[model samples]
Target: MDFSFPKNERIKSKKLMEAIFTEGKNLNNFPLKLIYLPSDFDDDTQFKVAVVAPKRNFKKAVDRNRIKRLMREAYRLNKGVIFNNSERDFALVFLYLGKEMPDFQLMESKMTGLLEKFLKKIANEEAV
Candidate 1:
């Protein structure tokens, strides 16, 4: 199996996104916070992720998109660490909490750190 999170498993449904905000489990690590709710997709791939940036903080769509793009890229590159754990698909939503416009370098570092924390959390959960 390819131990990578592909685009198909990503959570993009509007209803699913709403449900995650209302009922998803929360996991936080500094500039990033994750609201993960079990996905409806029945597949074995370990996980899927959606990245969100607040519009209130970033008044311009360009800024919002840039941050989201950086976040997704960072997650894509680092998430292999977690995906290697399971063949089952998991749904995840990454929400940016910082108010200011963060540079790509800061976003990349924070995102990597957050991903590492998330991977550890998943490992710990599975061990229980």
Candidate 2:
């Protein structure tokens, strides 16, 4: 597995973001709201993810950046489980929804659980 989260697999395009908001399913645990859609890329080695914190929740840019950084760090460390699995190429957007800033460990745990649930959801959908 290429441990890198490359740009091509990322959901950066405005069209893809709109599709995720309008077409993809939503999943959440605590501080995270996940919006995802399966990628057309057939490669089974890498996935792309984006972390976002709404300006409404965090009025200050610094706070939003901090939260996004923490979210990315958590995802980076735990994403190995997802990349190694058969369903590797996907576009995932993670939004931080909670009002208050959460500790890194707490956010990490929530991110990990959400990713596991995401993997299971994909597998189940493929099975159908």
Candidate 3:
């Protein structure tokens, strides 16, 4: 499976971002919160993702950027789970709730769990 995170998968729209925060349903896994909305997209990508590291929690821009980068990496690696199972498009935002910095291992593991749960929810399948 392809593991690349291409430019098209990034969520860059202001309106969609607002809609995600306002009306999307959320799934939480500790420091990682997955806010997902089923929507049609012009692109062929199965889902569009945005990563958020709150400025209030992370005061330094460097810290915030680092957290966002880590989250994106985690998502990129694990996103195949979502892509292979879903028949429709979605808008997803990953909101990091940790006040402190996290290692890549932690981020990736949390991302994996969050994604597994998301897949279960979407498929309406019994947990494995």
Candidate 4:
């Protein structure tokens, strides 16, 4: 499968962002947190996501931006877990919650675990 993170697959709408935070369910793995909301969107992409690094934890813009970049790369590589397994659209937010910086390997592994947990939860819910 193509592993490109096109702009259309990224979240940019203020309304959608607010809806994600207000109506979404969260799955967390320490430094990474995923908040996901099932929704209908005009785009054909199965998921539209945003990555955020809080300024409170990372005081410098450079630090926050680096964290966001790492989060995005990890998500881009690992998002197929949801894309291939599910048949619905979701607005997802990936939040960086740690006070310290993390390497890409750590980020990617945790992201994979978080997505797996999400799949299990969704499967259980649907089965029930």
Candidate 5:
């Protein structure tokens, strides 16, 4: 399967983003917090996502950009954990929450765990 994170899979709609933050469920895993909304779609093969690094925490633009870049790379590499298992479409936002900068390994590990937790949570919700 193609693992590339293309433009189509990136969440770019302002209205949708606002709705996701206001109404979506959240899961936190230190360094990374995910806000997600499950929605019906004609094509279930795609997930729209965004990575965010808050300026309040990371003061410098370079720091924020680096965090966002790491988050995106981690997600792009590990996204199959969600894409392969889920039958529904999801809109997700990854929020960086650490007070300090994290290394690549830490980000990858946490991102994997976060995605696993999200899958379990979604399964539980659907089973209820």
Candidate 6:
């Protein structure tokens, strides 16, 4: 499976970003909080995502960038978990909330858990 995060799968539209923040449901997974919404898009991709590291929590720009990078890597590697058995498209914003920088393994594990939770939530929503 292709694990590359392409341009079409990155959330870059300003209006959609605003809408997601306002209307999306959020899931808190300690170091990360995910805000996601069902989205309408012309492309066939199942999900588009954005990663954020708040300046307030990560004082240094480098630190924030590093965290964002790690998050992206973990998501890219495991995104298939969310793609399987799903018909709806989604826009997701992953907000890093921790004060301290975490290692790659921790980020991967947390990301895996977060994706599992997200998929279950989506399934529940569809069922209801």
Best by TM-score: 6
TM-score of each: 0.81, 0.87, 0.94, 0.96, 0.95, 0.97
Query: Model 5 misses residue 125 by how many Å?
Result: 1.0
Q: lDDT for every model? A: 0.76, 0.80, 0.91, 0.89, 0.91, 0.92
Tens digit of per-residue lDDT, candidate 1, span 65-114 = 98898888777767766666545456789889899877878877887777
Error of 6 at 18 (Å): 0.4
Residue by residue across 56-91, what tens digits does model 5's lDDT show?
Answer: 988899999999999999999999889988888899
The C-alpha stretches of model 6 lying farther than 4 A from their native spots are none
> What RMSD does model 6 have?
0.8
TM-score of the candidate numbered 1? 0.81
lDDT of 2 by residue, 47-104 (tens): 5577889999899999999999898888878878787775446778999999998889
* TM-score of candidate 5 relative to the true fold: 0.95
- Give the poorly placed runs of model 3, Cα more than 4 Å off: 125-128
- Give the least accurate 10-residue stretch of model 2, judged by summed lDDT: 39-48
lDDT of 3 at 96: 96
Cα lDDT tens digits for candidate 4, 1-128: 67889999999899999998988999999988989998898868888989999988889999999998998888888877888898878788999888899999999999999989888878887789
The digit string of per-residue lDDT tens for model 3 on 95-116 reads 9998889999999999999999
Model 5 RMSD in Å is: 1.3
